[model samples]
Target: MTNPVLVEVVRSGFVESVHRGALVITAPDGSVRFFAGDVERPVYPRSSNKPLQAVGMLRAGLTIGDKELALGCGSHNGEPGHVEGALSMLARTGLTEDALACPPAFPLHEPSMLAVAAAGKRRAAMNCSGKHAAMLSTCAQLGWSTTDYVAANHPLQELIRATIADLTCEPIETVGVDGCGAPLFAFSLTGLARSFGRLVTAIGGPERRVADAVRAYPWQVAGTGREDTVLMRNVDGLLSKGGAEGVHSFALPDGTALALKIDDGAARARLPLLLATLRHLGIDPGDEAEALAHNVVLGGGKPVGELRVTAGLFG
Candidate 1:
């Protein structure tokens, strides 16, 4: 694969992180709709891989009765509503905080963590704990041990890796430790996009449950102040999932899959670039859509500065 050009940004007269990567858009029939540089290069699809992990839970005999299913696939904010839903998931399987495999901590976002602490709880406040809880429940149903479930060599990790490879139609070339310290698999942008495309098109199959869950509880997928949740909720039949660092993906109902990665791992540029790319591709996100595509800031509750991305980059 040819190396993608090193796109650079300058701030204060110094070059910064080369926010460079590729994206792929494919159709239901597996035809490429769009392609960009170095799309074949490998990447570790982080939290963006959540939906597929939920698929493994289903395959392991996890009967995720609607609500549990939604919470399982969500990268939820530790909001009261989201936590309540996650707790209900644990309740259904007669499991509790002690059963979760993910480490104990507060939500990733400060505001959400404050909200969670105000509610007088700690365990449920952990964002990925919901996913860990679902995994534990699945392990129980499968008669497997919950201990070391997050370890790379654990059966859960193996299942997750296998499932990701299966969906992406690529071999797992390497594994890395994710932010939550779980195993992360590497695959090409094309492969990642292909996996998501399949997920969206498989709306009537078993995968449909995940799609339904994300669509139904878009708010739970992320929370207030999160772009993934906002994008999904606002876009009709479009699912948005964000990974740690710079990974993000979106799939439209029309069978278009898009994936992107920012090399510098700058959280700020990700969503803005994604929103812009989707728009350039003719995906209309109507009403205040420019707010997403362009970087506009408020100073003391009033508009102040605007960050304008170059349009030529898209072409």
Candidate 2:
């Protein structure tokens, strides 16, 4: 079935466009509270899988502290701190930036990207470098092969697969390569929400560790002015992560969880839909979130329209 329209673009009081997608929300008891569109279909969670991967790394003997662990579960903006953190992670493993399997890329943060433009793109500056470095560190500690840690059959990847299955309560429907070169596991949006619910509600073990790190070091997760960083900073006891191709997920300390994917991969639609879902759960993330949700569309450098969640979409 086709996905339902979840967001609308209003220009001069008229609907100019719409974004279609699927979303699922789970209650504190792990029951589906609300859902729209094809929540059962499997789709790539992309970097939304990072937190689960971090849990897998910890289970496989990764010993990084909270800050480093946060980075491991993040898709950072490649700011100075992010690059330095990835380097530090690699150094601790007796490896270097050269060991990262993710391709060289500029920072996602525009200022940082421009500042380092003269230095050229480096693998360490790629957003996924921290994740790759963490994988290498796990391999180093376990005496596994670092050269092909991103390989699907690699020990680290195998462990991560098991970890995801365990938390999501669903077998992975497909295996794919992530944007960062690591193995990607595809599962239903409902399963994704279920996993986040598990992460937030876990009292102990690697799941709690991953969730704690993401909450404690929100900056490490996404860098300055990013949505995940902003939301986590303002909302107490919240773990938020956004992935490539318009995937986003979050969970509150109460085990309230949400997962979403924009059908057309328009990143602009994500926050609006997210805010609508949060409202459905009686959450108010305040001014910054409001600003993000009501994203302005420009015409000749002036605001002419805005993106908004479709009226009653969540109801």
Q: For model 1, how does the per-residue alpha-carbon lDDT over 87-123 read when each residue is reduced to its tens digit?
A: 7777767787766656567776677777666555466
Model 2 segments beyond 4 Å from truth? 1-3
Superposed on all Cα atoms, the candidates' RMSDs to the truth, in angstroms, are 3.2, 1.3
lDDT of each: 0.72, 0.90
Q: In every candidate, how many clashes are there? A: 0, 0
lDDT of model number 2 = 0.90
Candidate 1's C-alpha runs over 4 A off are 1-18, 108-112, 115-121, 287-294, 297-305
TM-score of each: 0.86, 0.97
| Residue range 107-152, candidate 2, lDDT tens digits | 9999999999999999999999989999999999999999999999
Worst 10 residues of 2 by lDDT: 1-10
Cα error, candidate 1, residue 113 (Å): 2.8
